[model samples]
Target: WDLVCDSQSLTSVAKFVFMAGMMVGGILGGHLSDRFGRRFMLRWCYLQVAIVGTCAALAPTFLVYCSLRFLSGIAAMNLITNTIMLIAEWATHRFQAMGITLGMCTSGIAFMTLAGLAFAIRDWHILQLVVSVPHFVIFLTSSWLLESARWLIINNKPEEGLKELRKAAHRSGMKNARDTLTLEILQSTMKKELEAAQKKKPPCELLHMPNICKRISLLSFTRFANFMAYFGLNLNVQHLGNNVFLLQTLFGAVILLANCVVPWALKYMKHRASQMLLMFLLAICLLAIVLVLQEVQMLREVLATLGLGASSLANTLAFAHGNEVIPTIIRARAMRINATFANTAGALAPLMIILSVYSPPLPWIIYGVFPFISGFAFLLLPETRNKPLLDTIQDEKNERKDSREPKQEGPSMKVTQF
Candidate 1:
């Protein structure tokens, strides 16, 4: 690539076209996930990776490799989107932060798994094959998976929705309003209550709450900035050298391992505190990029490895945090928009690599501000600690209201888990 670029041949504009493709693909996937349901998109993602990854792995030419890799990027963000909405809606509120954090941690674990694999595999093509197979099986089981209950209820499918809710609660061992234990009873109650509510007035007017647009804008912008920094790090992985593949696999293993473990930690740490802490960690990680390039002579790879893992965890949790706060009726819409901007950020990340042609730190300096400030800003945000995934976008709007008046006057708001 440097050889081609140095000859006044390859241009930043050309490099960024791939990024643009990735961004467009992620936005498209977000909309598709909302329209079809999370499991559908997630299941399809494995198939996509299998096909495109195979093609790229075998490609003998640069053009084929670049094109196939671009296509792979399209399939890339599905795990992020579906997992956020899934765990946010399905996880017990008391453990939602831990759930999302642990979910995010899967990236770490996958990294560790691969580091071990690299000792044996020694080839990117073979490693891709090893990694892609199990995910395909996981995708198949996704066929029997349940859609999100919070999404269903908010979308007004309270009957089928409540059934799924009861199932989730049972699995989580959560006790709720007695009706929540039985779908038949919950639906019967909702059917009568909704009918009665409708007799007086419509349940949800599209325009009843207008601030939704503003909230989406905020969520989208935050996601865009956050992901730009996040993906920029990923995009530049090759800059760390030929051994970067092993480094990345190791990073994924760590993330996946964290996904396996952090749930226990979240059981104790508050959601808001965890998010702020992760954001601060991400900032420090980004800052360390400079130190790795400077002071850490032998440990640069180690520093970058930790930085990558930290960035991924923070990037994921931030999305989980944003998704939970959005009103439910428009949850999909809001998430799509958030994902769109994040993809847009991703599209711009490779551009930062192109800009590295001018000055290496220029991109890092500009990108680093995002995670650093996001942490500070998040510290000022409301605590979603122990808050159950909400039932509806309307429910989110009225979150300040009591489930069934806010002022019960307790030491902490005893948020219900569903």
Candidate 2:
């Protein structure tokens, strides 16, 4: 990097620019994917990410490197957000069935694999090549990627939507799926649903309808807090005075444990409870580290790893809670907006490291404060466990109202089925 950029400070500034690009990409990707169809925009995201990421690895000049990094940041976030949206849309039930433990264990395995790879491949250039080139393989299976069926149906392309559903059904081994999910049946169902929704309120107008706007505004702050603590602890991992690889591995293991613990808690508690608990734990870990390090010097690494773990758990809870809190109609837009704020906070977290020059504890102290306040923010959210996924703003409002009413036991209480 020094050979490429002569100024050390300018290199640091490059990280900020890269984060700016991510913020832009997240919003752009969400909007464009909604307009153009997920599969269509995803192809472009993949192609651009592969090309730009490779170019960034080979950038000969600092300006060129920074430019490529910015573009790569854009491509990376676009790809990430779109892929997540696609997966959430398609794999909601599968993911829920697998539970948090299996999912996080899988993530831990991926992290361990990357760590082992990085350990073996010490050369920066080779590591970059190893990472960048393999991404092109996405194109090989691109043909199998499906356009989002909900996007198709909402955009008045129900025929295309039906075809995709048929393909999905076939994949799930439903022999008579085509006959079962006919275009006529789908159109009738959608027409009835749309008419019911239209009887209450317009989708766009609901954004300004008091409760909904407040939810969005509060969620944005919660997301910002989440990413702030998550990435802050992540960025500070290198400063803990230990072997970097060992620290990272331990952090991964801690995250794996949290993942397992979260699922068990979620089984008995609400998402709001899990989210608040994780945030409180994150705050405790961060503050405890600062206090403990003053007395027990040998415990810094472990406490720091626990802080990262707590933040990781809180991050996952935030994602699940956000999806459940927001109605489906504006989910994409809401998530994109949240991603913009989160990425912005993530970009800013690294700057905290720079602040350590003034006082070593200043950065960690600030990081600890974010989750401390954010834990209370969880009170604003409604519990979503075992509830139907909200399809419209009115549905969310009704749910809020229903929560305030007395509960009826057994079959007397109605359950809305999707």
Estimated TM-score for each candidate: 0.67, 0.84
True-structure lDDT of candidate 1: 0.65
Across residues 1-418, which tens digit of lDDT does each residue of candidate 2 receive?
6634345446446776787688778868776876898888777777787787788778888788788878878887777666666676667675843443464566666666666777889886677778777768886679798887877887778889999989988998999997799888888877854554345345577457777677777778877887877777665565674566676677778777777776666567788877788788888877777676554645877777777777777776677678888888777667777788898898887777666667878878888898889889889877788878888878987887888898767875667784
Let me know the TM-score candidate 2 reaches against the reference structure: 0.84
Report every candidate's CA lDDT: 0.65, 0.75
Give the distance in Å from residue 418's predicted Cα in candidate 1 to where it truly belongs.
35
Q: What TM-score would you give candidate 1 relative to the actual structure?
A: 0.67
- Sliding window of 10 residues with minimal summed lDDT for model 1: 197-206
RMSD of each: 7.3, 4.9
The C-alpha stretches of model 1 lying farther than 4 A from their native spots are 1-22, 34-40, 79-103, 115-215, 240-246, 253-277, 291-295, 386-418
